[model samples]
Target: MYEDGEYGRGLVPYLSDAMMNIGTKVTYQTVIYPSASDDWILAELYKLKTMQTRVFVVHALPDLASRLFKKVNEVGMMDEGYVWFITEGLTSQLHNLDHKEDLMQGVIGVKSFIRNSGKLFDFKKRWKREFRSLYPDDDETQLDTSGIRLYDTVFGLAMALEKTQKEKGDSAMDSEGTRALKGGSMLLQSIRNFRFDGLSGDFNICHGQLQSSAYEIVNIIGTGEKTIGFWSPKNGILKMLDNETKGIKPVMWPGDSPVIPKGWEIPVSNKNMLRVGVRIGGFDQFIDADIDPETHQVTMTGFCVDVFKAVVDALPYALKFEFVRFVSSDDKRPAGTFDDLVFNLSIGGYDAVVGDITILAYRSDRVAFTLPYTEAGVSLVVPIKDERKSAWIFLKPLEKELWITTGAFFIYTGLVVWVIEHRVNKEFRGAPHKQVGMLLYNSFSTLVYSHSKCLCTLLHIILSHMLFVWFIIC
Candidate 1:
């Protein structure tokens, strides 16, 4: 499911084509629901239930995903049989969104693997401090993954420009002034070949795009998430890092089950409804096997029955089913173990048994089982204690070193302008009051590009050079 937006629509073909090239046929339905509305999600889910498409690739914004998953959880649709795969767009922004973690439990996300490094951590600390200082009132001030990409992008452009600037010699502006920065093409080529260790990871450009093959597979559990595995174009999905031989990490799936879901069980193309042998007693909530006196046919209805019917309806093809009541010989109740009930399926007494059947090691010999809807696992729950919490959290958006660096640069700019402009202008030839004011104005005006009309030409020249420096800094 993708958002009903132009960008979302544009991405569909790329994804579809990629899958099709690998001989995988793709069929999809687009959903356009009101933002953050559970009612709209439920309506769409109802349709999905009838079509029996167990796996869903959701390409939506984080806000929409939160609402959709909340509805999915409410309707009991986030079971083992269901799968939700989010694209990079939603996955990258998820960590910065509000209460989104709780809504995306058990979801699998594909993201460009951002390796941790000292430089990256330092950048993050600076970003956090600067962001808070700049926007003290804003609650959501975290730097997103895209911001790091943007940083690398700007750094790449600057490096490229610096190289081109040197090769083209001092002033790139031609006599006509139209050839300013004449190496635009050369700069682009330089950027395309740029390589460096960036904050995110290795920043190698190949085929006009970043050359990274590693992707992290994250599983959202509780109010947080973790990396359960990794996927590389070269090695496919692996339980751990390719170099690490450690076993796969435990996955806390939806509904708190550690059991990894088998994507799908029964194929949807088959036409026949499975002959389901339902146990009649013990617990009626799972399935209640009853007989219709008038039709003399076995009938079943309850939680398990509803779930079975829902899954069958969700299938791509039509299915026909007949419920057969399991009558134990010699008594109304089953005379033997639950294995006896499952044995009927093996002997052709029934094609499948849909009820509260205990899954065990021995049961595997008789018949295959779909993913269990019920959750069973042990989990370690811990309370998070943030000792760093303080009233001065607003200062967290920029690092102290960055703040100091910015202040030092501001002072340096004022000193440089005084040295250059003091000899060239009458404004610099004044008393201490006017001289200091002029110096401060020259340094600060770069931010607002403001100056008196008398000094426009001089300021323009200075501002032009300042603009280039500002661009690199930004």
Candidate 2:
């Protein structure tokens, strides 16, 4: 029997009815804490164990199985439980996680989508094993069942487990105890011979795939080297494994080549090498691979097959391209150009400016970029706290202590002139003594000067008057 929807709000009465009908004595508790934090989840689980409840029908979201497993470890319990019902995602989703080897080891069940239909006892046994291994203090009497999203987790696990067991014994029974339940050995063996299709595709519990085949193996690479795992693209799918009895020639790819049928040839006369443009600083990724015009032997350079594959995947399969060359210093740097104004960027030349191109000194030829591609105007570098909030980090080192000290001296010089003339700014103004000391700063700030006659005159008048007044007052 089963109940649905949000636990207490929708199915409490139904669950009670099912328990009563099943004649099973059950104990329950309403222990509440911050049901949110992972810490709370673990602490509560341990506390629940101490409470003598055999089964916990948790009412949380289905995705909390991983959390529950991790928290259970935090609570100092290992591999103890009779049964667990988790509220989680579809069984297929769980299987996918497992396939990726990303399955959280401790989680044993799901409740969200009850995907399997089979006998209950067998599933209960396996689930009991899984739970005990995860939370060992758990036993049959404890029936320590708990899930984050309790309902979905339990439903999904129960369904998948039941369906799986039924499938094991699902085949038609044979006489002479061949398919009988006597340890189910013969029956399991028969089932092993049974290649039944489940939600995860076709699988045989008995005769393993490639079990009967023997083949010659060779060491293509003499020493230890990178190995590529060959996976059947159609492994475990129904549409696959149902092919008519036939033979297809084994495909081989040559050494250092990604092209399939490793030694195949293409009938061609002259080979043509082509060049294409990628974004700046991506030339290393677009090597035109070498191929024999006769044999189609695709030989790539040191360690770039995946990169090649990615580029190949991006383009259409019908079209073929090969990588052949790597960039050299000559390609990267410019030797001669159109004029001093125009800098050459490898394949082309353009007008140049100071600091217009990024070159590794001798290694690269400077290229002129367009006014828009590069900043057109002189950079008005505002203070970091002001307009430079989004300035590039590369420019930060350029504004280091040396430049700041030089600029500071210039600033101090200007400030001293301003102060001596009583035209000093409020921000820099101090008493006469401080002004005198800062006037010592004047020598360093050679460029902190007035470029206009009006400013110069004002500065001179203030300085002249202050000198006269200071001498007279002293």
Candidate 3:
């Protein structure tokens, strides 16, 4: 809806609440056209043309609405895929205005319902005759729904006054000698409880307000309008009065087409291109923007650029965008930091920012950010010294505990060998020192594979083979 000062701006909240009750989400963007200048209207219309929303609910004075419709038609917005809905203020006055058929061809509007009856037909004939006599030159003037409603209001008031006069005297004087209605409150109560089948359908006043039975849904076709449907509180939108079906009749939309519009589209015009801001002198691996000297066309590349392009490609509709180098306003060069870029975005400098921007809490408060495409963390690195300078460097290959464990295993193997071989194989006789020396020789010789003594028993041979395998492993 266009946010004019008088009507459209004030109805936004009520319209939002009504739509919300019906489970529909509505986002209102206000385009203010404060003056009647053509340039101001055209400028606001251009902004609307770039937006994705095609459905509009207009609530403005008849003069402003007429101007808006004429400009909209000139810009080709009255073509297919656009839907225009006007409220009762403009709809009730449409019958008296002689607007162009093409300008209002596919527009839809709602006004108070006036049921067809012999009494209503006769009233229209009398109204036309009287209006013609009063202003003969104004042939376009006709009785509208507002006139019918006014007639009902006047008739109901007259009936209430007549009942008031019967109950009490016509006038009562106060201490100041000023006359007033004898039963003022009684008259108000009578008016509030009044109900009658008037020219404008059923006129029932509830809670001191006139209750509408239904609203006529009209579509502008040729020079006049066609009743496409009716919207009642009990049954919602209905194609016919007799049926319970909940839908409008098929309408001949703008461009003379019968196909239903999708009600939204991505703007592809060059003037409506989406401006994407890129960080200018950042780390080149993440984002880089270059400008040609001759043609002045910007070329954006790097990891961040590829990611942004992929995201756009995944959308169901085509999005036209151009990458702009984000520069400082003072120097016209790259901005100092990401915070500066985000602040500019919040103030309407760019439509979107694409780069390696960190998701800080302060930055998030300014502009929305996408899910972080890279992992979040920090890493520490230390340098290693040369090992060739130390004589004990060989011990660095294994821990000190591993070296001690290896030596203990070697001594244990020597003892096991001596215990098994001493029973039979030791040349069958030997001194204590000689046996001890022989044990040392047998155990240590396995490491160099220089043992010449042969095993006489199977147990000794098995121990010797096990020691040999351990030697090879070491």
Candidate 4:
């Protein structure tokens, strides 16, 4: 056995038999703790420190013999940092006592530990000085896995059987025969090229991992349980220590797959999701028609939704929004668009403005606007020359001084009314809504004031007509 990889006191046979008592296997069945990461082991204890699993129960022992006897865990030892038994409840845990200052409570093991009564076990080697010997050139903290691969005994057996079968059929077991297979080094590639099942997953691997020897776990740990969803191929990646949050950063692994704990979700940062909202059911100016919702998002012909996809792709991140809305003219179908830029924004409309939005700014303070994604062509409106000349003069721009005078007059009158309300009615200054109402009422009433009530009423009615202004503009 190579140094740390050797089986210490595991020569005893009766101990292995005792472990089968706690956990029996069907087809060598045992639940693996997903990973053998030191952090992985400690973490499993947290949610189940008071509870117990075959793996957890085995890890609780003191002496190597005891732990070996309890070999009920479906996982391999993760460099043996801490072992604990729960017969003493959740307390009386074990760890590298040199780093762990509190050894007064539980029995400390320099090389090995055997409980006073309950069958607890200790470690194969003393960690306090053993670490110094393991890494003579560098500190223990600098230790890294230069070559590692997470192994699956089940997969190994399957591969061995496959080799055995292929050799029997044609006596081809070496790479020479491997090269004869159509697709390259990858078993997935070979499977796709040929029609034979070897390993990895069912139906021959195509997209993901292959059965190349380049991917192999250095360790073959056995227990009685099957772990799922975790089997990292040995590739270069950073890693962490046994659940230690302090002074730790990403460490690279060269060969074996690092074990991840079962049931622990991988942590991920809150990434932005691409969002896009369309003016669904709004006026579509392209073909000049409103969208009808009774039709599915696809067109009335059941072909496509609005050309919103095209427009959204053309838009910047501005296309994202909490709500999804799209607009399409009844005459035209949705235009498909594509983008490669990372988009993290959204789009949508505010409070029920079900009308049209032309090239004019709506509420100035409501939203921010970018330079137009598109441009409109210039338009010219010829000035009508009134032959009489008087009406045309008013339509032309006024003199600078005349404009200033009229603006000042409006400002002065407004200030006077404001001051009066502020002084005479404290409540007006506090709220001022009533004062504003009165000012508007008085100004309009004075605009159409007349000696005859009938004429005043008629003039007021005619001036307030919105259609009158519309007609004049037209």
Candidate 5:
């Protein structure tokens, strides 16, 4: 973690509490540097890279984050699996970061939700117009959320002061420049309860803190950021406005990959590689670990080993690890069961165990397991037969029950039409072929509104008369 002193005070504790509540053991390291100290920032980034910390939670001014990321990108470490999570302080300044967009690409940040309303849009338009007219030479003069919030706070305080003066009568005049207000506590209380709609949405306060409607999860794309989702205290993470909607827009992740990142991996600080335990008994084809006689180095290669390496590499951090053969000193036979290898992790014999280890309830109680990457239980592999070809493939999208229900609805509609119009209608009283065609047309037309010219005229008259009767009844 790298941040300036002022912003770090509030942000650090909140992030620490969040991590602790989720049972994550974090090794917190803080780097305090001035906002414009390039040398200091470069040194810190090098230290972080050495520590193998791929995910950095940056709590600083927007300029500092831009400088730090520029240095990081220059080092060629800004590719896949690196993550930078920033606080609202930096995100609010995104408009001014047009020049540093490449440095900040793939960054994730949080901001207070500001709904797009007509009133808000109008305010933005006027603000921009006035800004352009006043400072025509300045390129970065856009209003941000913080500025709006500050504007609201000043107005709220003014209203509270006015109310306090009315309640305190003439005594409020004496406290204007004499240390504090005569009813300052009362004025503060009034401000806390103030509620109204402002340019940034609902201007409200609760328990001396501004109530946040939601936290927008933004992803930095090209030159600006896009809202990929939102997190509300009431509804948790949502892709859309609410739970009923599809989701937020898709995000372009690091390296332009569309997949969501797995946020962590083993650290490779201190030039220490991970001590991996691999079993070599029952599943030789899945995994095989042995010592190279010529090189005297441990050699491990198999399906399971390949999968483990891929997972480690896919983590949003850099990790250095080497597989160690989990066998007895005798260099013969096998060790114990899969349970023994897992127990080794607890006993400090290995940092992690990788093999055909089945995740059972008993094993889970002893050690934690990640989400399984492969299918469990048995799978039968069958040969493909190229004998059959049919036109029924078009119906495969619908389920069997759905097809039956649809056919039943069509038949029922035809029967009901025949019964209703067969007696008096000339269209229904026809030859066998003509009767079938008329019945099919009537059945399908009921699904869609279609009718002959004569029937259409009669239906329009009936609808108009019904509407007239309904209007009179109302």
Candidate 6:
């Protein structure tokens, strides 16, 4: 993988872990760009072109990623046998990218999936009209996943507020005249429990987060992204949602090649021996380097050294390499620190580094570290204390908003029935106060099947059936 910035740094470890779990070994190389407009892009592209790995996972902001891809295309790295996969951060904003058709052609990307529905279609039409009116000059008004999620959020809040209003009337002020929603806690609870079939698929909130259902895998083709497949927790990768197939659809890869790239190959450059850097003074058990005076040949041994040799030997093809000791300027001792050794590898001083090198976040920014062979752990112990529970803890099972919503719906249903039956049924027709009393008594009494009133109007029966159907569907 070739990436840059903090996003790339954070993503590399997870990608490494996932690949390792699948019995695949991955190597990562960082592309350091001092700034967005740096002239080093072309040079960096050339350097990457000389490397053996053709498959690259890119994780950078849209601007930097776009520039990098442009340089990649200029250097002919987008040709056959090359593979590029971009993360959701860049892929989600594909519409904002300049010359994306040329820069991102045949690039594979994964983005949050938004299912198609009439609701989404209508919302898009209205959104496009309003967005165009506000920004007439801007052509990129198409809604993305972020926009869809934002819309869903606002819609959900509105629904929660509407329910709150029905349950507790308008917002009220305290004795100190501070305005607040009459049932603020209930409002928050309603928001957390809100669920809907929204533009962004099933909008369900759990543990204060909007749950993601699946990811849509897309391939950049011409002026748009082509949905090649989908990935979900339940199903791995499926070419069709209804199909149980385990792999993605055939991809139109870079250089328009239908054949899959092998991901890596031996560098074509004349340099044959891989320059492996070894720290000179690490613990002898992890690594040790020695030179024979008679033959003047360097021999490397120890745990790390043996493992490295075994890995290279197990490769499908022969890998010629020689261990190069990283020594001080005086040529008598090891380099300054492991940081110095990794920094040198970043600058092309070594093709790879092997020894008792600890993986640190700072060092990872400059170079990638392979999976550690050593077991690592850290534990912290803290004193535990007992505390008395709050008196309101009894309300914890169901949220306060759920209780309020239930009461509100009971009253609402009763009011609907009364409106339909008051004109025809004697039980519903009475003095204003008496009818109001009956409304409350019957509403609550229905929960215990203690209501004495009977539905005498056909409208009431039909409305009851409609409510039953609604409850069933919900």
lDDT digits (tens) for residues 1-474 of candidate 1:
888878578898899888889975565566665463667678877767655456778888877777777777777768766777888888877876566655667887878788888998899998888888998898846566778888998998888888988887756546576767866787788888899878778889976888865778887776666888887767777777646544456877665677766545454454667677777776777878666779967667888899999998786544678876676675377645578888878788898788878778888888898878868677899998774687777677778897888777777777667777777677787898887887777777777765553253665677678767767765
Give per-model TM-scores. Answer: 0.55, 0.20, 0.56, 0.16, 0.60, 0.54
What does candidate 5's lDDT look like per residue over 152-203, in tens digits?
A: 7887888888899899888876656564567778888898888988777788
lDDT string for model 6 (1-474, tens) is: 435667678887887899899986675566655374546878766777777778888877777777788888888999998999988877888888889997888899999988888988998999888888999997745688878888889999999888887887644335455665668788888988889888888899976777868999999999999999999878889987777888898899999999998776677774778899999786889898778989978889899999998898677444778888899888779877888899999999999999888889999899988889957787799986533376766666767787787768778767866777787679888799988886776665543552335656565464556457446534
Off by over 4 Å in 2: 1-8, 30-35, 76-78, 87-474
- Global fold similarity of model 5 (TM-score): 0.60
List pairs with backbone clashes in candidate 5.
Answer: 239-247, 239-248
TM-score head-to-head 1 vs 3, winner: 3
Global lDDT of each model? 0.74, 0.39, 0.78, 0.32, 0.74, 0.80
| Separate clash counts for every candidate | 14, 49, 0, 37, 2, 0
What ranges in model 3 sit over 4 Å off?
2-10, 29-35, 171-179, 269-474
Looking at model 3, which ten-residue stretch has the lowest summed lDDT?
Answer: 169-178
The residue-by-residue lDDT of candidate 2 on 143-240, one tens digit each, is 22223223333443445444555765645344465754333454334434454433322323346331221111111222211112211333321221
> Could you give candidate 3's per-residue lDDT for residues 38-84 as a string of tens digits?
77777777888877777788777677778888888888888998888
lDDT of 3: 0.78
Over the full model, what C-alpha lDDT does candidate 6 score relative to the true structure?
A: 0.80
Residue pairs in candidate 6 whose N, alpha carbon or C atoms collide under 3 angstroms: none
Model 5, which residues run further than 4 Å from truth? Answer: 129-137, 175-180, 242-249, 264-474
Q: Model 4: per-residue lDDT, tens digit, 1-474?
A: 000122222322343566667673211211223224444444443433222121222222234323322222323332222232222111122221122222211111111011122211111124335667877886454111110111223344356456544645444335565635332234443333332322222222334443432211111112111111111224321122223233222211111224322311211232433443333333344323334678644322111223444554554222232233333455254222211010111123232221233423434234443334357577799998666668576645667886676556445444444454445444345446776764454333433443132223433454445234434433
- For residue 313, give model 1's deviation from the true position in Å: 17
- List the candidate numbers ranked by TM-score, top first: 5, 3, 1, 6, 2, 4
User: How far in Å is the alpha carbon of 390 misplaced in model 2?
Assistant: 99
Candidate 2 lDDT at 469 equals 43
